[model samples]
Each structure stands twice: as structure tokens, then as C-alpha cells.
Target chain A: MKAIVVERGENTPSLIETPVPEPADGEALVRTLRVGIDGTDFEVLNGNHGGFPAGDDHQIIGHEAVGVVEDPNGTGLENGQLVVPTVRRPPEGSNEYFERGEPDMAPPGTYLERGIDGAHGFMSEYFTSPEEYLVTIPDEFAETGILVEPMSNTVKALEHAFASRSMFDWSPETALVLGNGPLGLLTLAMLDQTVERSYCLGRRDRPDPTIDIIDELGATYVDSRETPVSEIADVHEPVDFVYEATGYAKHAFETVEALAPNGVGVLLGIPEDWTFDIDGGRLHREIVLENKVILGSVNSHLRHFESAKESLARVPDWFTDDIITDVFSPINAEQALSSGNNRIKTVIEFDTR
Target chain B: MKAIVVERGENTPSLIETPVPEPADGEALVRTLRVGIDGTDFEVLNGNHGGFPAGDDHQIIGHEAVGVVEDPNGTGLENGQLVVPTVRRPPEGSNEYFERGEPDMAPPGTYLERGIDGAHGFMSEYFTSPEEYLVTIPDEFAETGILVEPMSNTVKALEHAFASRSMFDWSPETALVLGNGPLGLLTLAMLDQTVERSYCLGRRDRPDPTIDIIDELGATYVDSRETPVSEIADVHEPVDFVYEATGYAKHAFETVEALAPNGVGVLLGIPEDWTFDIDGGRLHREIVLENKVILGSVNSHLRHFESAKESLARVPDWFTDDIITDVFSPINAEQALSSGNNRIKTVIEFDTR
Candidate 1:
């Protein structure tokens, strides 16, 4: 078997040969089909984010994967079933977060993400996972099921953001997505179905494909260089909802001002340590006086994965083709991890039917 | 009719003889009984917060009042009914926030808060209000109903906080109140009925009345000088719900770290402009990775006033006596406004039974 691994403090991933293992009780042996790469993958490669598996010099770094079940191992799944694995697993026996079936709510030390933290990933020729960690999708979605993992996170973030406004009759008219990356585009696509008007803010100019995708999705494209997020309400209109994916520390603060009264901002970005000056009083006063809500969301629960399957099922086929900008084989895994091209979503192809 | 009014930039309230107001159609003339004083009143007096009524040099300043209807100009209320008035009124006809019956969600410019901003307050011996703004209570509540106005803000804040967690099975076992002023003590008293363990943080040491009240309420009192808010999770257990009433700007950021996993912080304090340094990346990452929620709430709606009447009805009579420490006549309005004495709650008596 061959796997892609990132050694400690390395900026590039390497292909290595490893022995295939049999599935244990309550586990399924899966033949990897495809794995998606995003910002988190780049962070893992740089060794600035995610933890290495205990006592290991390197970690297999892929969390968004779609695989075919080779062995159900007495679980509910069947042989040759199409499945997508969820990322986080409990550190040990049941704690509160997992016992209640909400590993998404688990804090830092209580859980580990496969391929990203304290656990090996599925970017390999063969992988084994507990049957409970796998979600089955229709066989027709073999090309797009790999997106179920990232889409699940979007599902959870949007769900929580809407839930926060459940107390009031919150009908948002406009929405702003603070990034134009793959996740941001996916979020924009999802919002496009409901919000009357939507805008996608990014650094890309007219030459980029993401800007065109934004236009194609029926959303206005606002370049960050031309109008900063804080000035969006002045240049454009105050948004009723803001989906933050840039992980730029300042966007978190500016999101406060960008929102209209009774609006909510859902944050999904994770950034590195950086200190800066801020008008703490003005921000505090704005939120308190305007009835604003800012919520932080990361990872997803099984329910969200199920919901993501339904959401992905609704996405048009042309979108899947337009967003997946790069696909590489194991020999070019490093290039797949560090592509400098204007890419939206990059993936590693592990096996064919 | 006599009223207590604060001129712009004045730190002291003055007792002035104003003309008695008459009730118009859809309006009610009320004889004010008792009016409570809190931090917002102080802010208005100092001219650092709140706005003056249009074209007015001074603003009458009391929003927390219990009164008797002297003249019901034909909406619903009968003469001599005991009532408490809500604070906010829409600027003009039909805004989205008011049309949906949610004046609390109105932004700063959309509405005016009586006594605090852009409207004459209830501090006068005689006041006029639209019938819809009055919430009737039991006659027995006249002595304690003055607390209803401030308590309504608490009801709204807590309601929004709980609503934010409605997406999950959020059964919080621990709670922390970040200030020990009247609002904080009132909040602690409210949480005492549900949360198993509660703590109130303040700057007071031994012999302070608030500390005694906190202890009497069966909640631990934490001195801010000893254990900073950011260290609460280390010295004590991380709080699952944080009620922030301290206007100190830094507590807003410290609150991010003070929360437990899947915790929520509802901010009610309004601070002044102050620039400070903060690790923005750390705060952003902490919120995202921990599934924390921070919501800002101010003012209260009509429904919140109705709910607060029920909450105040359940409070023990002894608490009303213990909380209201000082009562002064209109001749001593300045003394009532600037009592240097140690006090929990103060009131200005405008009429006797």
C-alpha cells in the first residue's frame, strides 16, 4: 500500500510504502478512491496546525476522503458500499461530548481528527475505520462524495448560525461570504438558494475563475482590495448574515460592523498567533447596541454529515466540475499539496473502479 | 409636576417643576410611584452615553418605574391600574424591528429609549405614554414592580442566550455572572433557581454588601483582584454560561477564554471607546475550535416585560427589601442620583399610596 505523509516541520508531503492492515471488529476495510485538499491540509503540511499522532515522526494528512468498503466486518455496511468517513474520534472511552453524539462540540484535548490531529488520515491505498465513522452515499455520487466531508462543516456552521436567531423572527435579506475559496464558494452556493441577494468578497481580480463562479452563482463579487469588509455597508448594503472563512484575524472584528441589525456572523476560520490594536469599546458597543451575534464553529457531527449528503445531492453537476480545479496521482502528491495555480479545490486520486 | 432631569454633560440631576402631561387618544397618563436607578442612569448623567430628546437641552432620566394609571385615554387599561412601562419606542411609523414586535432588536438610530435617549423619561411625577407601552401587574406588585424595568433586560438577555443554545441539548450545570452590581445580582438570583453551581465575580472584598448577598444567594463570590476573569477556568471550573454586565472593555476579550467548551457569553454591558492590544488570532481560534458563542443584547421588548413581571412576582419579598438599599424624595434627587454610600439598588419616591 502507498500513503501520503507529512513529516514534522515539513512544508511538502511525500509518498511512502506501508503494509495494508486487516479490519478489526466493528471496523470496515476501505479502498480509498479520492481525497480532497483545502487550507487545513496546507497548514498540516507546514506543521503550524494540527497535532501529530502520538510517538509518530510523521502523519498521513487527508481528512476529506471517499472510499469503497472492501470489508463490512459484521457492521451494518455491506461489501463494496460507497462511504465517506467523518474526521473526529474520541480520545478514549466516552466523555460528555461524544456520549451525547456531539464530537463537533468537543474541545481541543477531548478528541482527535483523523489525518489532522493525533490520528492517521485516509490518504492511502487502504484504510480501516469504525463502521460508525462512515456515512454511505449513493453510488452515483462517486465523483462528488469526497466533498461530503467539507460540506458537512458548512452544514453545521450554517445550522448553528440559524439556530442562534431562532428566538426571533429572523428573515435575513442579504448575505456576505468573506472568502472566495472552495469552502466559501460552497457556502455561497448554498446561500444562493435562499438569500435574496448575496455577495462574495475575495482578493481575486477579474482574471480568476472564482470570480466568474461567484458571478455564475448569481452572487455579486466584491474584491477585498477595492472595498474592505468594514466598508461593505457603505459601498454596498449591510448584510443580514456573514459567513467568515478567510481566517484573517481582522475579518473577525470587521464582521461585527459588516452585519445589519439582528444579523449573525458564523466564523469558521482558524488563524495563527498575531497581536493587533482594536477599538474594543466600539466593537463591544456595536454588538450590544445592534443586537448582533458572533458564533464560532469547527468540525461537524454525524447529523451534519447526513445533512451534507442531502445538500451535496442538490448541487448541480456543473458546479462540481467547475470547483474541482486540480486532481493528481500519488506520484505528484507534493504538487497536489502545494499547487501555486489559481485553484479552488485540489484532490488526490487514489484508485479507480 | 416635578421631574428629575440631567442637562447635557452634567453629572448631577436637577429637580425641576414641569407642566403635568395629558393623555391623548391611545395614550395613558400615569402617576409615577417609584423609579429605580442603575448604571445606565449614571451613564446618562455623565453625558458619556445616551442621547437627548430632539431639540431638548436636558433629558428627564428614569426608565425603571412603577406607576398608577391616573387617566386611561381609551385603549385598554382602567383608571388606577398598576403598571410598568417599557423603554423603547420606534422613531416613526413602521420599521421592521417594531412591526415584528421586536423593538429590542432595533439598531441605535431606529428607536429611542425613554430616559436614556431621545425621549422624556418616567422620572417625572406625571408621565404620558401610549397604551401599548404599559404592562399591567397585580396591585400588590407596586412596591416591587419598579425592579421590573431592569429585570426585563435580564429576561431578554437570558432568553436570547438560551435560544442560542436551543440547537443542542444544552443543559448548563455551571454559570458565572461577571459583575456584582444590581443587574449582576439580579441575574445571579435568577440563575440560582436552575444552574447547580453559580459564581459571581466582582472587585469587592469582605464586608461588602454585594459579597454577602452573593453568599446568601448560595453562589461563590470571586474577587477580581485575586482571580482575573481569564483565570476563572483554571482556579475554578470553566463556566458554561457567562453573564457579562461589567462595562470594562477587557472583560469582553477575557470572556472568550473564560468560557467552557460549547459555552456561551451574553454581553449586556456598554463600554466607552478604548484602544487596546489583543491576540486576535488566539481569540478567533479559541472561539472556532471550542464552539463558543458570544451574543450582545440590549433593551427589552413588550413580551420580555410581560415575562419579567412573572419573574419579579416569583422573587421573595425579602430580596426586594435587601436589594433596594436607599430611597429618597424628589427634593433629594441629586442625592438619589449620586449616593456615595455603599448601595445595591436606589430609588426615587415620587408618590405615596
Candidate 2:
């Protein structure tokens, strides 16, 4: 079997040959169909974000993945069944989070991501996973199942943002998406279902595909160079909900001033260490006096994956076509890993069948 | 009738002669019994927080008040009934907050606070309020009814805090109260009923009466000067719920590190402008990875006042006696306002019955 791996002290992916893994009890053998490459992959490649597999110099790195079962190995999974694997396997110990089937709520240093942390990823020809970690999807998702993992995170973030306002009559009329990245576009598409008005803020110039998609969805796109998040209320109306996908740190505070009364902001970005001065009192007052809430969400639970399946089914086919701009074969995986920000979404194809 | 008023450019409260108000068709004339003095009153006197009434050079300064109805004016309220008036009144013209009975959630400029902003407060010997603004209380609350106004705010804060976590099975075991002033003490007293183990953080040293009362309640007293909030998890177990009552801006950011996984912090303090540098990335990462929530809560609605009446009834007599350390007559109201931090709670009595 062939796999793409990032060795210690090396910040680039390389082709490596390894033997195919045999599925043990309660495990199923899967042949990768497609694997998504994201910003986390860049972080892992640069050795800046996640950890390497224990006792191994390299880790196979791809979390947003789709595969077809090759061997059931006595599990309930069927051979050739289409499946998507969820991220965040429990660490080697007694973890109440995985015990309760909620690894999404687990604290950091307690759980490991399949591709980004202690476990080897599915950016290979073959992989083995516990049957419980795989979610069976319909045949229609075979081409787009690689998107399920990222969409699931947005599902959980929006669910919690609404849940935080469940105690009041919070009918949000307008929403703002702080980043025009892949995650922000998906969040904007989801909010379009409920929010009457929506806007997406990005630093991109015109003629960008993401901006075109924002316009196609009937959402206003404000170039962040012309209008920052703090001045959003002055340039446009204050939003009732803010979806922050840019891990810039300052947006977390700026979201407070940009929200209308009784609004909520859902934060999904995680940034590196940076120090900055902020008007802490104004941010505190807006939240306290206006009855606002800021919720921090990361990863996704199994239920969110199920909801994401329905949410993805609702997205028009043109969006999927417009968002995924690059698809690379395993032989050219390095090109997919080093793609610039202009690329909307990148994927590595292991097998078509 | 005599009233305490704050004149323009003078931060001191002075006695003034005024006519007893006449109850209109929808209004009820109330004779003030006792008015509680809090930090908000001081802010109004300093002219740094709230605004003076429109077209007036002076503002009456008391909001935490309990009184007896002298005239019902054909309203549902009964004459001689014990009543507590809510602080916020809808601004002139149509307002949605007052219409929905949720003035607490109103935006900052949409409403006015009696005594603190744009309206004459209950500090006068006689005051008029629309019948809908008064909450009827039991006879037992006559002595302690003044506490209802401040306690109502905590009720609203805790209610929203728990509501934010309702989607999960959140059973908070340990809690932290960030201040030992009147609001923090009341919050700790309320939390003592449900939280198993609790701690109160204050700068007070030994032999302080607030510390003694904290001991009486069986909660650990932490000297914040020695143990900062950032080191709470190392010094004591990380808390599941944090009640912030200190208006110091830094405590808001420090709360992110003090919370346990999936925990929440409810901020009730309102601070002034202060610029400070913080490691924003660490704060953002902790919230996202741990599923932590920060809720900002301010004034209370009418329902909170009703719940507060019940919460007040639950307090033992010794607590009520020990907490209210100072009681002053109107002629000595100046002394009441300038009392030192050693005083646990202060009140100015206008009438005993």
C-alpha cells in the first residue's frame, strides 16, 4: 500500500510504501475513496499545530475522508458500503467524553485527532477503523462525502449558537460570517435557511469564486479591507448572529460590538499565541448590557454528522462544484498540500471505486 | 416630602424638598419604606455611569427600594400592599422590550433606569409608578424586600447561565464567586443551596465580617490578592460555574482559564474603559477546545423579581441580620453613602411602616 506521510523535522509530504493493515476484532478494513486536505494539514505539515503518532517519526494525515468497506471482519458494516469516518478518537485511558459518546466536548490533551494528533490518518491506500467510528452514508454522497466532516463542525456550532438563545424570544433576522473561507461559506449557506439577511466578510478582491458563491446565495460580500468587523454596524446594520471562522483573535472581541441586542456569536477559529490590547470594558459592557452570548465550538459529534448529511443534501449541486476547485491523485499529493489560499478546496483521490 | 438628589457637577447627595406625587389613572402612589444603596448609586452621584433625567439639572438616586402602596388609583394593586418597583422604564414612544415584558434584555439606549438614568428614582419620600412596574410581595418581605431588587439581578444571571448549558447534561458541582460585595454575597448565598462545594474570592483578610459570613455558609474563602484567578485550577479544583461581580475588566479574561471543561461563567460586573494586553490566542483556544461558554447578564425583568421574593424567603434570619450592617435615617443619608468597604450592606430608612 502507498501512503503520504510527514516525517519529524520535515515540513513536506513524501510518498512511502507500507503493508496493508489487517482488521482485528470489531474493526473493518476500508479502501480510501477520497480524502480532503485543509488548513489543519498545513499546520501538521509545518509541525506547528498537532502532535505526531507516538513512537513513530511520521503520521499519515487526512481526517475529512470517505472510504468503501473492503472487509466487515464480523462487524455489522457491509462490504463495499459507503462510509465517512468521524475525527477525535479517545486517548489511551478512561475518558468520560468517549464513554458518553461525546468526544466533541472533551477537553484538549484528552483526545487525539485521527490525522492531526496521535493516530495515523486515512491519506493512504488502505486503513482500519473500529466499526463504531464509521458512519454509513447514502450512495448519493459517494462523490461529496469528503465534505461531511467539515460540515459537521458548522452544524454543531450553529446548533449551540441557537441553543444559547433558547431561553428568550430570539428571532434572528440578520447574520454575518467573518471569514469567506470554506468553513465560512458553508456556515453562510446553512444560515441562509433561517436568517432573513446575511453577509460574508473577506479580504479577497473581485472575480473570486467564493465571493461569487456568496452573491449567488444572495448574501452581501464586504471586502474586509474596505470594512472591518468593528465598523460593520456603521457600514451595515448590526447583525443578530455572527459566525467567526477567521482565527485572528481580535474578531472574538469585535463580534461583541457588531451584534444587535440579544444576539449570539459562535467562534470556531483557533489561533496561535498573539498578544494585543483591546477595549475590554466596552466588550464586557455590550455583552452584559445587551444580553449577548459568545459560544466557542470545535470538532463535531456523531449526531452533528447525521445533521450534516441532511444539510449537505440541501446544498445545490452548483455550490459543491463551485467550492471544490482542486482534486489531486495520491502521486501528486504534495501539490495538493502546498496549494495557495486562492484554492477553495483541495482533495486527494485514492480510488474511484 | 424630602428626597436625596445628585446636583450637576456635584458628586454629593443632598436633601431636597419636593411635593408628594399624585397618582394618575394608571399610576399608584407609593410611600417609600426602605431603600438599599449599592455601587450603581455611587456611579450616578459621580456622574460617570448613568444620565440625568431629561431637562433636569439634578437626579434622584435610589433604585433598590421597597415601599407600601398609599393609593391604588383604581389599579389591580391593593392599597397598603408591600411592593417593589423595577428599575428600568421604557423610553418615550413605542418600545418592543417593555411590550414583551422583557425590559432586562433591551438595548442600552432603548430604556432608562430610575434614579440612575433619565427618571426620578424611589429615593423620594413619595414616588409614583405605573401599576405594571410594581411586583407584589408577601408581608414577610417587608424588612428584606429592599434586597429583592439586587437579588433579582442574580436570579436572571444564573437563570441565563444555566439556560445556555441546557442542551447538555450539565450538573455543576463546584462554583466560584468572584467578589464579596453585596451582589457577590447574595449570589454565593443563593448558590449555596444547589452547588455542592463552593468558594468565594475576595481581597478581605481575616476578622472581616464578610469572611465570617462566608464561613457560616460553609464555603471556602479565597484571598484573591494571594491566589489570582488564573491559578485557581492549581490552587483548588477548577470550578464548574463562575459568578463574576467585580467590575475589574481583567477578571473577565481570567475567567476563561478558571473554568473547568464545559463550564460557564456569568458576568454581572460593568467596568469602565481600561486598555490591557492579553494572550488572546490562549483565551480563544481554551474556550473552543473545552466547549466553555461566557454569558453576560445585567438588569432583571419582572419575573426575576417574583423569583427573587422566593429566594429571599429561603435565607435564614441570622444571614439577614448579619448582612445588613448599617441602617441610616434620611437626615444622615450622607453618612450612609460614604460608609467604608467594611460595611456589608447599607440601607436608608424613610419609614418603618
Candidate 3:
């Protein structure tokens, strides 16, 4: 099996021949179809993110993947079906969270996230996944099934954000998403169901195709470099929900300021340690006086994956088309792995035959 | 009418004779019985909390009071009925939040807070309030009804903390209350109903009455000055919910690290502007990876006040008795308002005549 692998602390991942995996009982042998590359994969290659398997000298670098079960191995999983495996698995002697189907909220250092952390990834021609970890997608979404991984995160974030406001009769009319990447755009797409007005913020100075996609989704795109998020509220109204995926530490603080009264900020960014000055006292008072909620959510559960599958199944064709800006063949796998900013999403293709 | 009035930018409050208030149409004349003095009142006197009312040189120094209706003025409130008037009222030409019965979540600078920010307070022998602003309490809690104001804030915080965790079956077993002040103690009293192993952290060194109350309620009291909260988890298990009432900004930051997976830190503290060095990057990662929630809750709504009245109704007599340490007449109002660190809660009393 040809796999894109990166040695520990290596910046570049190279194609290598690894032994093909076998399906054990209750596991399925899945042939990789497509793998999406995002900022997290880049972090793992650069030794920036946590959860590198302790004993493995090389880490397979991809978490958002789509594939087909070649062999069910008595798991009841059907062959010729597209599936996206969940990233995080329960830790040693699984705690109450995982026992209850909530590995997404498992205690830190307890779960092993495939590709980005402790487990081997699905960025190979063949990988085996437990029957419970794989969620099937409809045949209609085969081309875009890889998106289910990232989309599920947005699904879980929205679930918790709405849950935070359940104390009162909260109906948010507006939302702000702080980033124009694949995850941010997906968040904007999900917010359409909950809010009337949604704004997407990015660092670009001019019009981009991603901006057009944002507009096509009935959301306004504001260039953070020219028009700050604070000014966006001035031009419009204070955002009731802010989905932050910028991976910049400062935007987390700025998201706090961007919230309306009783607003919720769902943070999904993982940034480098950078000290920024903030008026701790005023922030405290604002949180207390305004009843603000900031939730830090990572990973997703099986339910979220199922929700993401439904979202993709019913989504407008244009959204799925515009999101995956570039796709590369196995020969051009390196290009897909090292995607530039010009692309909204870059995926590497694999052949089943 | 004799009132405790603190002139703007002054620390000393004087007992001054002011004109007794009269009930206007759709209003009720309430005969003030007793007003509880918390740290917020002291902040008002020291010019560190909020401002004096417009067109007035002084701010009345109380928001937590238990009183009786003298005249309903055709508003349907029965005379001699025990009541606690809310401190915050909606702004002129009320907004959506106020109209929806959530004035507590009103945007900053939009609502006027009685005693604390804009409107006059309840620290007078006679006061007038809108009929809708008053919540009735049963006769059994008359002596402890003054605790309702602070308890309402905790009620709202708990409501939100649970709301944030509503996405899954997250029933917390352990809790941590970061302060032994009146507000922190009240939070412990509330957490008693939800969790099993509740812990209270305070700066006190030796055996105190508050600790005794915490023990009596089946909660552990940690002397923060001796054993830091970070170590509390090391000695025991990591906490699931932390109610922060310590007016120190650093505790809010530390609270994030002390939480378990899906843990929520409900911040009720209003600290001064002191910038502390924190690893923002690491903190962001902790939030994302652990699925932690931090909610900044300030005020409460009528529902919360009613819920607080219910909590107080079912509370043990010893818990209520030990909380209110001292009660003073109008002549000793200064002593009541200027309670030292040793006291839990102090109140200034007034006669209905």
C-alpha cells in the first residue's frame, strides 16, 4: 500500500510503500477514496499539534477521509458503500464519556485522534477501522464524502452553541464566522438554518471565489484586514453567535468583543502560544453583565457524523462544488498535501481498482 | 425617610434624611424591611463598581432587600406581602430582551441597574417599584429572603451551565465553588441539589463558620491560602462545574485548567483590571481539546428570582441562620454596610412605620 507518511518533526510527507492492513473481526478493510487536507495535517507534519503515536517514528497525515469498505469482516457493514470514520477513539479503559457514546467530550490525554494524534491515519490506499467508528454516506455524496469529517465538527459546535442559550427563549437573528477556510465556510452554511443574517470574516483584502461562495450561501463576507469584525457589527448588528476557526489567539479575544448580549462564541481554533494584552477586568465585567458563553469544542460524536451526513445529503450542489476547490491524483499527492491559500479545499484522490 | 447614601467618588456612606417615595400609577409602594450588604455595595461606595444615578450626587447603597408592599396602587400586589424588588429595570422604550422577560441579559449601557449603576436603590425606609419588578416570597423565608438577590445570580448561572451541557447526558457528580464569600456559599447551597461531592475554596486559614456550613451541607471546604485549587484536583478528582465568585481575575484563568472534560466555569466575580500573563495558545488548545465551557453570568431574570425563592424555601434553617451574620438599625447602617472580612452577610434594617 502506498501511503503519504511523515517522520516525527518532519515538515514534508513523502510517498512510501507500507504493508496493507487486514480487517480483524468486527472491523472492515476500507480502500481509501479521497482524503482532504487541512491546517491540522500541516501542524502534525510540522510537529506543532499533539498526539503523535509514542512508539511510531512516522505518522500518517490525514483525518478527513472518505473510502469504501472492501471487506466487512463480519461487521455487517456493506461493501461498495462510502464511509467516513470518526477521528477520536476512546482512551484506555474508556471513561463514562466514551461509555455513553460521547468520546468527543472525553477527558484530555484520554482519547487517540486518528491521523492528527496517537493513531495511524487513513491517508493510505488501504486502512482498517472498527465497525463502530465508520459512518456510511449515501451513494449520491461519493465525490464529496470526505467533507463529512470537517462538517461533523461544525454540526457539534452548533449543537452546543444552541444548547448554551437554552436557559432563555433565545432566537438569534445574526451570526459571525471568524475565518473563511473550509471549516468556517461550513459553519456559515450550518448557521443558515438557525439565523437570518450571517457574516463571514477573513483576512483577505479583495474579492475571492470563497467570498462569492459565501455570498451564494446568503451570507456577507467581510475582509477582516479592511473591515474589522467590530466594525461589521457597527455596519450591521451585533452578532449573536460567533464561530471562530481562525487559529489566531487574538481572534478569540476579538470574538468575545464581537458578541451581542447573551451571545455565544464557539472556538475551534488551535493556535501557537502568543501573549496578547487584554483588559481582563473589563472582559470579566462584559461576560458577567452581558451573560456571554464561550465554548471550546473539538472533535465530534457518531450522532454529529450522522447529522453531517444528512447535511451533505440535502445540501445545495453549488456549496459542495465550490468548497472542494482542487482535487489531485495520487501522482500529485504532495501538491494536495501542501495546499496553498488560493484553494478552499484540496483533496487527494485514490483508485479502488 | 432615612437612607444610606454614598456621594459620587466617595468611600463613606452617610445616613441622610431623604424624601419618602410615593407609588405612581402601575407602581407599588414597598416598605423596606432589611437590605443585605454584599461586596457590590462596598464597590459602589468606593466608586469602583458602577455609577451614581443621573442628576443625583449620591447612589443609594443596596440592591438586595426583603420588604413588604404598603400599597399596590391597583397593581394587584397584596399589601403586607413580602417582596424582593429586582435591582435592574429595562431601559426607556424597552428592547427585545426586556420585552421577553430577560432584562438581565440586556446589552451594556442599555438598562439601568438600581443602586449599582443608574437607578436609585432599595436602601431606604420607603421605596417605589414598578409592579412587574417585584417577586413575592413566602412568609417562611422572610428572615432569609434577603439572600434571594445573590442566590438568583447563582440560579441563573447554574441554569446556563447545565444548558451548555445539554447536548449530551452530562450529569455532573462533583463541583467546585471558588470562593467562600456570601455569593460562593450560596452557590454551594445550590450545587448541593445537583452534584454529590461539592468543594468550596476560600482564602480563610482557620476553622470558620462558613466552612462549618459547607461541611454541614456535605461539601468539602478547601483553604485556598493553604491548598491551591489546582492541587484540589490532585488530592481529589477533577471538578465538573466550578462556580467562580472570587473577585480575582487569575482564578478565572485557573478555573479553566481545573475543569474536567465538558466542565463549565460559571464566573460571577467582577475583578479589577489586572493583566496577568497567560499562555493564550495553550489555553485555547485546552478549551478546544477538552470541550470545556466558561460562562460569564451577571444578573438574573424573574424566573431565576422565583427559582431562588424555591431554593430558599426548601433550605435548612441553620444554613440561612449562619449566613446573615449581623443586622443593624438605621443608626448603625454604616457598620452594616462596612462589614469586615470576617462577616458573611450584613444587613441594615428599617421599620415599616
Find the 10 residues in a row with the least total lDDT in model 3 chain B.
B46-55
| lDDT of candidate 3 over B1-353, digit per residue (tens) | 89888986578888889998878899999999989988888778878645667789987778999899889889989988999988888767878878888887777787888888877899989889998999999876667889999989988899889989999888899999998888988889887878989999987666788888888999988888777876777877889999999877877777877888789998988776777677777777778878899899988989999999988877788888889888889888777776576688888889845
Return the clash pairs for model 3, or none. A51-A117
lDDT for each residue of candidate 1 in B70-185, tens digit (9 for 90 to 100): 99978799999999999988886759888888988888778888998789899999899999899999999888898888889999998998888877778899999999999998
DockQ of 1: 0.81
The model with the greater DockQ, 1 or 2, is 1
Q: After superposition, how far is residue A204 of candidate 3 from its true place, in Å?
A: 3.2
Give the lowest summed-lDDT range of ten residues in model 1 chain A: A42-51
- Looking at model 1, the pairs that clash are none
Per-residue error at A98 for model 1, in Å?
1.5
Question: Could you tell me every candidate's TM-score relative to the true structure?
Answer: 0.96, 0.96, 0.92
Fraction of the reference Cα-Cα interface contacts (below 8 Å) that each candidate reproduces:
0.88, 0.77, 0.82
RMSD of 1: 2.0
Ten contiguous residues with the weakest lDDT in model 2 chain B:
B43-52
The local lDDT score (0 to 100) that residue A44 gets in candidate 1 is 82
